[model samples]
Target chain A: MRDPFRSICDDDLERRWIWISLILAFAMGGLLGLYAVASNIHPPSNVETIDSSRLHLTEEFAEDKLGVKQNDDGSLTVTMVAARYGFFPPVIEVPSNTPVKFRIASADVLHGVHVPFTNATAMIVPGYISEINTSFPTAGKYSFLCNEYCGLGHDSMWSRLIVVPESTQGK
Target chain B: MNYSKAASLGLANMWVAFTFFAFAALLGLYQVIERIDLIPALKSPEMYFGSVSTHGVLMGFVLTTFFVAGFGYYTATTSLKQDVWNRPLAWFGFLLSLSGVLMAAVPLLTGNASVLYTFYPPLMAHPAFYIGATLLVVGSWAWCLEMVMMLATWKKANPGETVPLAMYGTTTNAILWFITSLGVTSELLFQLIPWSLGLIDTVDVGLARTLFSWTLHAIVYFWLIPAYIVLYTLVPRAAGGMIFSDHMGRVAFIMLLVFSVPIGFHHLYMDPFHAAGWKFLHMTGTFMVAVPTLLTGFTIIASLEVAGRLRGGKGLFGWIGALPWNNPLVLAAGLALLMLTFGGFGGMINASYAMNTMVHNTQWVTGHFHLIFAGTTVIMYFAAAYYLWPKMTGNALYSTRLALTQLWLWFIGMLVLTLPWHQLGLAGQPRRISSTPYDEELVQSWLPAEFAMIAGGVILFTSALMLVFILLKTHGNSQSVENPEVEYAESLHSTQRMPHLMNSFGFWVALIVVYMVASYGYPILQFFLLDTYGTVPWSI
Candidate 1:
């Protein structure tokens, strides 16, 4: 009986193409994984937690300590709180060519910090502190925003990241 | 017991599915218009979110569940050459789901449950919404049980026979959905319902997100499987060719079942509750799931290539032009693969641990999902409906020309819609927002893409209405014409017998259980073991 649905057997060339495509796909995946690890471009591991309901009362997230500060170790630490409609310290200034650690936490629900055109991004959960290390190579103004859907204000939930020249680092 | 009865059962379910689909499509158009600030009347935030939530649930949960259940019944009856095991029980499931939909619709339409389908807590909805959603899921479990039992009964009666490819795929999806849904079910029963009812003052947001992530990603697979089924079993025959390999199709289904469930944590890559280590593990599994999709692409394309070659086409790629472009199924499969290739690349970026940070929660994520779900999967659903409508109704289609035109319009509209979404995401636009009036400068840059998206939405909405019109016309057509029975593709090499592992789900099910436990065990346990704080529920 003739079956209309049956097809001709795959030729050697077609089989070769299939294997090549599969291998290339897997290899690309492996390479991407390797680059992520080797470059240390991943979600930060400076694991810490805070009481969400009492964030304002905490010393670490006190209004006085909410902007860029020069740490004792000569590195800069930017501490900010992501809240209902905006990020605390809505505008931050950082020195170009200097490694900075962004210590961000959410005051209420889940939020995400995503800086466009750079790999400086992390989730800001209410209780957890997300810390990512990065350096801006060029001096320019960049905007970062809360990417996760928080509430009605999610679309306008944004902050500015102002990177200054390295020569004026202290300013 | 007869063919007509089985067809009627499937047709009834599909009718409900298409109705929800039409409603959701209209809501989608309104959402785009609202976001663009094109209409003052549609500018209310409460109503915008309500429409968004309803659109997501209707398209994601209601339409997919009903359509898959209906398609599964039809495939099982026709392929196995047996009536559904319990016909009345199946109808009961249908009615139960429809009632659940109506219950959910009340709060959704009233703007009380505008938590936008993800329903991630701290933000809570009405108690009735949770109860209604629970009922819908429970009703679907009935369909799952029916599919599994039907396959088992068929196997017992036809001992030593391999399950037909179509039936085998339907059964695999049934098992996949059963396991995939447990996460959401646990979340609803233990947390959301209690919190919504004011029984629990506080809910652990971390734990809630963790449970949801379990169901979040794998559910996409549940939606895609029916499309894959149509591609493997029906498209080949419709194209006048066989499945490239029966064994390969089974391998793809099994791989999807095993790999899809354990990788749900990929959705949580941006969520802080899960450690980065667990996220990495899930990312690896996500990459593994891509293998089955690749295998599927090769098999289906190879089948099409053979069909084209057999039609007297010459040269290396000349066979493509020789195949039946007039056939809706063939055209849909071809377009679906094209969308899958582009969408699959975006998915890879989302799966990568570091890269996800760039696009997570952005409009890029929205673009990726719409391409896969609305473009690849829903297009096939349309094709399958077009193919089966004639068989089910015992009448000729109202217009093949209209059907083909609608398919092309859907493809073009989807590309036009989603490509700009990816661009807007890169331009720093966040999703699930009613408007983007933030910085004049930044919002200005997004204007062109937003306009393009509005145009795309108009095309899609028009195409959606056209589809409903065609189906309605075909069902109501008075023209009497001969109707052909549904025909599934044969395999290139027929199998009289197969190994137990390939033929049966026993081993696979056991293996999947082990894998899921390993992947999800510790991450979930830490929430309870550690002193985790819960925030008081806040409702709209």
Candidate 2:
């Protein structure tokens, strides 16, 4: 009997499958690339590191300077610290219809912050800063949730994000 | 060669794996109910997180590592037509790994290691937990050595003859594991163990996480490869046909090995440490691993297509219907492939850098993994056990009917449970929460999904118990088979004279080393160069 194992079309079929699969995979990659580059929005990947132990002593994340402050560039910078059980500057008050840039860092361990039903999310790893930029279109009350499992009180690790009207910023 | 020695060893390892699996499954059921906060008596955060940690460890590490090593031993011996290269070492490895499991279990079961299976530090576990985990991986290294040595010995004796695909896969996995495990073992040895033991006062969190990401993603592929091996080598024959493409299977296995190791930075996409360039690099590499999965899907379906047509089915869709559904292995492939389809879709979303934000660290991540690991991967583990039990035990299975029923329940349980979790994740439910005591409206909205998950959990627990019962009954089964050792499906074509690149490992290993250095070199090195602060361990 001829070696039936020496059959045709097995490699041929597989070669074609490889091409098709590769094409399919790259197409998805291309689409995601286009969305990332074209839309210019993505998960925060800024590589800024800060000594978390000295976060309160730092100029950028100083305890006195925490929470939303108007930048010289006419944008809002919300500097918050993610400690074990809660976010620092516990309830943030930001003006809606303005660009808000968050500079979050973990004071202890690791934590993640996510604004529900929005693309505003980041993992706050210790020894680094989480810088995410977003804008709230309308005045509303939202929450900054600790999404990562930090410690025992992670269940209650949430604070209010009260987005008030731009005119009511001082209030 | 006394193959029964390999069989007995495999059986012993498998029983230990199932014991952990059953306990973990019960924890899984408790977790679903606990998170719902329905029964006030079950509302303890410490208990909940401890259960979650133990559940993840038992299911993810203890069950998979034990089962894969056991199955590999069986495959190595039978496919190579040789006894294990060092039987005493194999037994020694088994005992060491088991001891590690027990040692780790002490901390995990007692709420001291509620860090979850990810073991994110400076969230400290008991020193024993880290030590035990290290010992477990180290023990598995012994099996890896045995696998490589046995295959090398066989090749030397055979001289340019094709390596059997099953043995090829087992060896590839062994080598893949040796490479894959280096990252975690380093993390354990250099950082976690020392920090937990008070040898080191603090740890660089960014550096620790970067080291972990190296092992995190590939470890999933480690759990998954044994299932793929069974699919490529055994399922087609059980369904009444040969492998549609044996050569493709080898290439697929190689791709899984090479691509899986370097792409783990995708897990760190949402984190603050890595910059955009490196994350983007890992994301693309992550997408590259998907190709092998697609290839495996095509090859297996094609093989089944042949089997169905050989059994007198016709047309594009008719063959699916004609498959030997009564056969447990065949039924499993059908269900496993179906789950893989959905799980693969979820994986693509996770791989895409932009889309990963939507599901990252949410219940969707949890759901996606359970579907792949529990739904696609573990189901196949069940089928492999069912298929191999009679051959290993010298007795026919007590009830094939019960086995079939068990599989369906597992499938149903996974879908019903995980589908709602995706919904909850989208609605902004974070993973690893002990309870949903959040905004009343938000908590209320998640109620229906939580209830559905509890139902799913009950069904899954029922299915798990059924699996354990069946295995136990099979051992005591009276009807014995004449030939306990059975040969399985052949590939459509011989792999002799395939390109040396396809068969060899040296080239692949070197390529992955270059790839890993390129992907991770700067990201990890920055910790030393930059003013990164280390932290002392934190108590929960």
Candidate 3:
């Protein structure tokens, strides 16, 4: 009698295909990881405060302010304020390709500082400053958003980093 | 009081619910495709938000509520083997729910109610939306009443005979939902409805959220119990094996009922108004619920093993291959279990107090739920439909082959859709958005995954079309076919009587009440008592 259950034992090729597919998937994942590592870009080398464009966010940013502001003669100044579950001073205009320092912190809850255009994002914890030393490479409108589920007014929380062309500034 | 009429009425309600579910699913596919940026024509923020909000409401609220109520009614009538006590009231419940859905859809379709599926206030929806949702919940409460009363009636009638396992689980959910939904129901009725209607000045957002949280977590278990019911009562039998332990099923149900409620704090881990101590306590309960799930897994696997071995499998795990693959229920159960394991793992990460921050509102949250609710629970629902269609219609299924293919496609499609979604979440993509308008880098990173998701949606759409076609064809078939009566598996070690607690809900209810009070009482009170400034210390 031809056994009905024989297919289970005999289907070695089918099992092998499953294994092969899984392996291929892992291989593709590894390749993607390698590509990410190879093409990695760094944040602006050294900046005290950086601000440049108006950005619209899908959710609110919990950061009290977008970025930091430094002084002219050589004094580094950081202003930290409180905002209610959203980003304040949403648009900050700064000179293009200039190094500026920013000390960013959340007043209410945990908020994610996401600069989608620049591939820069960080978690802004309440009462903790997340310092990112980066210069906006281009004069364009860039946006930051809170990627966290902060509160009811989450969607309205947005900030823009406006990078002005260097020649236009102090005109 | 009529059994046949109640069955007909309840089954019709389920059919309506499934129809809504199917509609939601099609919209879901469209939304997924739109998210992928594959269809340029389908990329409107208004339309996307509308479709998404409608889809969420239809699937999460409309589908689950109607199905649970209908199934509850059906089970109450059958397992009790008595007529439903109030036929008109049941129909009234149905009409109220149906009307509520229609009312809510007006805003959803117009995109006026794109506050997303969750009506977390301050970002307000139309008054009709809140009123409609409230009506839907209120209608379902009647069904809950019927369930408790029926169980009480059965106890009165039968005196000492143990309530059947099916009836036992149904009653547990009925009781749980009644106690559970009150928090949200009150929030909608008192706060949201009045506020949305301009009847109230400055709504208390914190209080409203707190109330919503109370219902939020328990409602998941409410949606889940029907799937578990099928698992315990139907799957074993479909697989040609007996349930491993009747006591185990009861223990699981009891555990779910008692433990599922207080764990809502996990959702509030990052929210204000709730204290750390409370969140920690709820986290413990959340983890404790895992015990029952593991128990269910063990019992279910063991049951399947018994069936597989009996079919002449030789080795310890070789029994796996011996199980039937063609039977819709068995196949669906197998697939559902696989999805459950992965979804449950994601759930554990989300429920974990520390790790939850990694993927709190990200696509990971969406992916996890889609896997569990759509992948695990909905697949079983399909299996149940397949098993019940013949009985309901008194005719044969249109095509077993098509049904089997649909099941496979659904499972495959879910994996295709959600796996990429989880990856995107890890790579930092937020859920509930129209498009990646700016953020070129994020959009570029998300595009490939989004494209993959579109393919998944297409597969799922094709699968859904097959389901609709098969069901319709089955309904249109002329001659009545004589199919065998559905059979539940007999236990390997059959006994004459079940354990007292296994057959009784009284002890479980008392335990749940105590657990809830011990867990939630102090936590909720602290919110009102704590003196906080602009920001509450207990942030989500």
Candidate 4:
């Protein structure tokens, strides 16, 4: 009588096929990881934290510097706040074809920043700052929405990213 | 072996599980319709969120728990050829869990606990909700203990014999649940309960989320292992073939237990509570866990191929056509593997550190989970029930044709429901929302998909009703029938001389503890160590 619980591990042909499948699967995974890293399409690594309750009173997130700003190094920095109902600076303007660093945090609860058409996304949690670096290649309107469920108003929590052409400087 | 007591207990638990499943399916249809804004009367965001929360808990917690317990009872009794070690204690567990479900249902239905299933603070639910959820977890722990004790007692009696594969798989899941559940147990007992009762002024949302992440991803496996067990133990025999590899089955089960628990930080990839380094570490673990699933797929397919070949299959792929497709268990397994392929790909994308940004928290995530959980896992549950119901009740199935129809409807409905959800996620539609009145142009593109989903939900709801009707009719029917018994798959080679590591779990349990500590210790401790800010509780 044959054992019903036996395996094909002992069969040479089947063993070879199993090895091939395992290797192919892992290789595919490896390639995807490599592409993500080489393309700079990954989660941000800049670790920064802040006091969530006092975000509005801070220097960087004060009423003046809460949106997009042209930095001294010819790069753009966009600072945004995610609250209960919507994102602060419901619309932001950045120059296309230039690197843009987004500095984001949640004022109340946990939210996520997802620019649907692009690879610029990160979590917005209270007491911690999330930063992502990416640049828009084309001048267009892109909508960034809260991906995490916050409350009843989570659906209404969205903002617009208007990437103007680099030729439209200081307009 | 007289299994009357065990069969009755199993029947009772499964009946409760199916009832909750039917209720949840109705709520699921209503949700899809409401999201499309088709009916004005069902358009309340308050009611919608309440229904969503209840739907999630009923399906995620109630149905899976009760069904797994019932399945475990039947598996233990049949596989080991012994009565359940502690019958009275099993009943106690069932009653306790049922009471917990009732306690939680009040707040969940009345909109007092509309925090969604995650129940992250500071969106607190009523204290009763937290207490009820706690009781439910505790009751499940009783089943865990019973499984482990049964295995231990059996091993002691038969000193050198290998434990049965079904019993081994059940015990593995039992240990995994005990460990996987501790995270949520701590969160409920310490943070949510205190804040909900006004005993605490503020709750640390960061800590709450961190702890929840510990349980979130692993709990999916707790729901899914039984499905996998059925695939390995029953599907092959049902198809008239032996399992291709019993050792591989043990290997897969062990890998699942070891790798699944420590990889949960991937759920927090978009959350701010954990550092990128920790998230990346967990991402690697998440990718590693996919190996066992891949192995299981290979083993099951190989088993089927062998079965087909034995049935006069010819050529390279002729085996596929030769195997039985009409049997519900075999058909469901085939459909399940199909869904697993697509769902597994989606999971890899979500688990990737960089690619996660593309679909994070979008309807893509929702679609991915539904494909895996509802499509792959629950379908197997239905197959297992269909296969087991007749045996447990000592009656013929009401209608094999209806069962087959129900299975096909579920598979088609799932594809219809989830495929568009993936597209909507790419189109910028956010999930967990009552309405998507965002950009009107973007929202317009999603309208077709939403309508299709409602149609799919209706099909699924009808299928759910049919399933319950068949089970009830089968139970009540008076037609005399042969007393059928469970027939587990056999292996081509003897498993009497298996390696010690494959035969025991003592080392695996110790390894899991060390791995969890290494992965989660610092991430959770930083909240207490640092002066993390807290938020006031906000209840509905």
Candidate 5:
């Protein structure tokens, strides 16, 4: 009221709007920060990089080894290769109620995989490795598919994940 | 009036922008139909990918770049009442950019560059595409130079004068463009061109993505600034009211420049090339950028409220009704703000550190951008054209009724097109796919919403055609308006005794430089320091 020439924030409406905007921004930051902390409760975070071109020759991602492996610690690690049109071992069987880690590498180009309606998703970029960890609580067959456009045959780039009851795991 | 050069420049560039917009709208229609498998004849993967890629490139690059540059030239001349600094150099830039666009079109149309608008590596495009894209950006650099020089020249002649708000926003956009484009230009010149030309055997995909992310998000703000400029400078006057605050305009522009450039890592949230910590850091910065947009929404609305109230409006919400719906720019500003609200909400969901996984590369992402870019941003471009076209040609608009009709159609059409997209994405449909060859049963659930989207696309295409038709008819119209001088709205508050920070570019520009290095410097360097490997290109 004293000085209209100084700044517009002196106006009541402007001040209220500024406060509202700042509060919304801070609320957003806070929510994202909270998500960051909560989601990190899982032990592993993926910064792992492997030679994408040599995945087939590697001991870890060799064709024979590209499926579910029951670790001594009881967690399952699924090593897979995402090439142009398909994931290696196209089908994998895992036990429900067990934590599983997927270490996927793109043999060529860029690819993304997602098990729809679930968070088992990652971008499979060549020259780097993608690792995602989660547990399937319900026993069922999930259509795992590549969501990114890697090539012309990208539509065919899909696989199946079968999560069996933990009681039937040995069979 | 000595604005003949400015008018000619604006007309030429805007026509090019709209021409591409019309073509892209047709491709957009085809894309939706193709995606839904609505037309069996459009099932060819080659054509589908080619059309999608072209649609993205044309709308994102060709339309936005040309339109912004055109809008900026007219704004600078009109607002500052100064001659363009260098007419010959300016035209040269326009030609160079046009030639570059034409060169890139060949491969894109032929499906040889189906990598989409993103210059992602490990999947390469024809070398001509990269080279042509580089030339286009380089040519725009000439405009950037001219903008800088023009503003500097104007300031020198009148030392104490605050830069006219319209030109102020334009020059800021120019500087923003220069800084942000460097990221992608470097990626194209050093990494993509060499590989596409076969001068190199393999390219590191990580580094390529990290670099592209540098340009990815910021470029949207660059496209968006012109729209905001129209809102800040043109809309209030168009609605018959004073601007709420010119200082808020400067603050928002500076914030857009400073925060937008450094926060691009939000695009790389899912990509493993960057660390999660870096992505989170960028996510925070992403939210920071929204502050400007929020402020913008308030200021623009306040200005319109003032207009409505000044026209004898009373009570709390009565002003909204009092505002002229016949005035194309006012109606557009109202609609643009509405879409921005929807689009901005979707952006918040996408920017959340964790929620992005659900929508990343999904139809939700696609819908979000279409609303923001096509709905919120492009609608304003339409208003600017309607407002500027008549002035540029010294003719009355062919039909104000048709102009209002076109704006209404575009608004309704965009809502129809994008709202269903969020539904499809929520149902777990991915983006950029030519067809859904999923489990027939799962896809069955997606068909209804997708069919709705195709309808939306058709509406948008028709509206786009109407726009081109209206502009063309206006060009040939015999009637002329009495006053053709450009008029930006005056502020409710006096702009004198301004803060030193708000008046000058030095502090903000320097702050952006430091912010960029701090945000992007080490994340890019990590690829080299780590055991990163280059991969051979994979062509479809």
Candidate 6:
């Protein structure tokens, strides 16, 4: 039999390569994690407060309590409500480079409120409120979709965070 | 009891299933198009939802169930070295299920039932749909009963011997499905029936959802076990090698039985009816099920590696190419595993307690399932059919070239359809819809992907037609040659007998009982302990 396991016999080289790749992958993952922690520590500047009472929100509109509006102070209050399976007031607006406080609560189902762009996340449960105090450093539109399969309409339920430049808010 | 007759009956049922599947797939193509609303004429939401629902049932429920039962009957009898346990009863079950399909088809075709094939209430379907679906499930129950009885009989006759590996896996599936479907069966009989019939003016939505949740997640495993069966029992043999580990196969099956059911709460992650604690518990169970899958992956790869090495291939991983690629079973298993990586990744994301929120209802979810069910599972169905057809018909396949082409086309088409589908989901495309008329800018961006999917659909439809064509040609050609006996591949490492725990029935069943109680006991009990007002929440 002509050495049937010829390529398989060169096991040392293969083992070496596998080890190298594994080490690199772990290193990259660790660096990414560290970067996330550092960014959270030194947050952006735009901050705004949302009065929960002024909004007409129920279980259905739990996510929509915060208007994505620009303030005179160049900050944004991204209001949120956890209704049924997702955020009721999904969309929030803020001025760029402003630190924002996202006041969130649930009227019904539990929800994981995640802002992918900011790498910020929090959990919301019924009758309890949680907040993500963060800032949008850049000007762009990032969407907030219910990652939870809340119900039949879960796919269509999403809100956007529109971060505008401070110069444009007055205009 | 003759081989030819049994094979004919099996092949006929398979043909019926494939035809329904082909037509349903065509409907699916239209559904994707209609959702984009690129074609204005196809803009009826009512028609769209109806077609989508029927398409789901035909492909997911009817096709898989019928193929499994028919194939199981033949494989069982032949592999066991005996006739079917009860030929008449099997036929009766077949007929009952077929009748139910036709009855359900009436409402589905007429657009009278558009409840999206889910057991969720408040969105109710016609009474006929429930009754028909019930009959179909009831019919499969008969097949399950036969499987258990046949296995028991075989054990009794062959004292102090291990059941054939193939037969063992099939019996495990039979057992798994019976236990799994009970959740849906209870819901349909007691809840959906009464609500649809107007016997109950207002049913408990939370209770009904909980009951539905029980079946929602596990049923996928019921669909999946047959695929895993093909992988463990058929794939190795097809590859010109023996199974790497029989113990691994047993463990995987046991895990599937124990874990597939209790993890239903992962589907209820977003439901208001369930508490976070219960959902979290089920999430843990969901992750636990991944153990068997990882085991399956290792065992299968090792088996393939052994085969490759045996074939005189050299270099680490170079043995991969030495294994037979021309064989349909080998080809399919390869493709199925490749899809499993991506499908399994999506499943992990879905199973992740927190990460699920990002991909919940997006095209990602749709893309994930299609990869698993259509990409992984259906390819195995194709491979099994190809391998078995010549044996069944006592004639060679009309064209192995066409068979190879069909499989290739299927793999390519699935990639074309699903790759963009994932992007479209990330781009925020909702799944169940009649039109994407809103957000023109957004819809325009989706246009290219939708177009690619259409092309993919065309290729798939053509491939499906070719599949039916080859089977039909094989059936018609009259070559009076004797069919070769179905041969299982010998293992690379062979043994005469195994331990009782690995080979015995009693130990495994006890293990299943203990596993189910530990996994599901607390999660289910929590619903009862926590108080809810008027209607009692249905417990799985």
What local lDDT score does residue B305 receive in model 4, on the 0 to 100 scale? 91
* lDDT values, one for every candidate: 0.85, 0.88, 0.70, 0.86, 0.87, 0.69
TM-score of chain B of each: 0.99, 0.99, 0.94, 0.99, 0.99, 0.94
Q: List TM-score per model, in order.
A: 0.96, 0.97, 0.79, 0.96, 0.97, 0.80
- Tell me the RMSD of model 1 versus the true structure: 3.4
User: Scored by Cα lDDT, where does model 3 land?
Assistant: 0.70
Q: Which residue runs of candidate 2 sit more than 4 Å off their true CA positions?
A: A1-11, A165-171
TM-score of chain A in every predicted structure: 0.82, 0.84, 0.54, 0.85, 0.86, 0.55
Among residues 3 or more apart in sequence or in different chains, the pairs in candidate 5 whose N, CA or C atoms overlap within 3 Å are: none
- lDDT tens string, model 4, B1-540? 677788898899999999999999999998998886778787788888999999999999999999999999998989998888898899999999999999999999989898888996777788889999999999998899999999988989888898888998999999999999999999998999988888887777778878888888888988989999999999999999999888788888998899899988888776656767787678777877887898889889989998999989999999999999989999999999999999998998898877787787889999999999999999999999989988888888888899999999999999999999999988877778888767778888899999889888999999999999989988986874465789999987688787778878999999999999999999888887876777777654
How many residue pairs clash (N, CA or C atoms closer than 3 angstroms) in each of the candidate models, in the order given? Answer: 2, 0, 23, 7, 0, 19
**What are the fnat scores of the candidates, in the order listed?**
0.33, 0.73, 0.04, 0.41, 0.54, 0.01
Tens digits of per-residue lDDT for model 2, A1-171: 443323323565676778788989888878877877898866798888888888878988888988888878789889899997899988988888889899998888899988877778899998889999888877887777899999888999998888888887674
TM-score ranking, best first:
5, 2, 4, 1, 6, 3
> Which portions of model 6 miss their true places by more than 4 Å?
A1-171, B480-483, B510-540
Q: When superposed on Cα atoms, how far off is each prediction in RMSD?
A: 3.4, 2.8, 10.3, 2.8, 2.0, 7.3
Across B53-150, the per-residue lDDT of candidate 2 in tens digits comes to 99988998899999998999998888889888999999999999999999999998889999988998889999999989988999899899999999
Looking at candidate 1, what is the lDDT of residue B230? 97
Give the 10-residue window scoring lowest on summed lDDT in candidate 2 chain B: B494-503
Of 1 and 5, the candidate ahead on TM-score is: 5
TM-score of chain B, candidate 6? 0.94
Give per-residue CA lDDT, model 5, range B1-540, as digits (tens). Answer: 589899999999999999999999999998898887877876888888888889988999999989988998888888888888999999999999999999999999889999989866787899989998998899899889988898999989988888888988998999999999998998998899999889999888888887888889989998999999999999999888989999999989988999998998777777767777788788889999999999999999999999999998999999999998799999999999999999999999988877777787889889999999999999999999999998899998899999899999899989998999998887778887888888777789998888889889988999999999999999998999667888889999888767777777998888998998899989888877988788888787
Worst 10 residues of 2 chain A by lDDT: A1-10
Fraction of true contacts reproduced, model 3? 0.04
Candidate 1 per-residue C-alpha lDDT over B1-540 given as tens digits, one digit per residue, 9 for 90 to 100: 357877888998899999999999999998888997767776777888889999999999998999998898888898898988898888898888888889989999998788878886787788888888888888888889988999999889989899998988999999999999999999999999998888888888878888888898889999999999999999998888888777778878999999999988878776666777787788778888888898789889989987888887789999899899999999999999999999999998888887777787779999999999999999999999999888888778999999999999999999999999999988878777888766678789999999989888999999999999999998998875474577889887666656667788999999999999999999888887867778876555
Model 5 scores a C-alpha lDDT of: 0.87
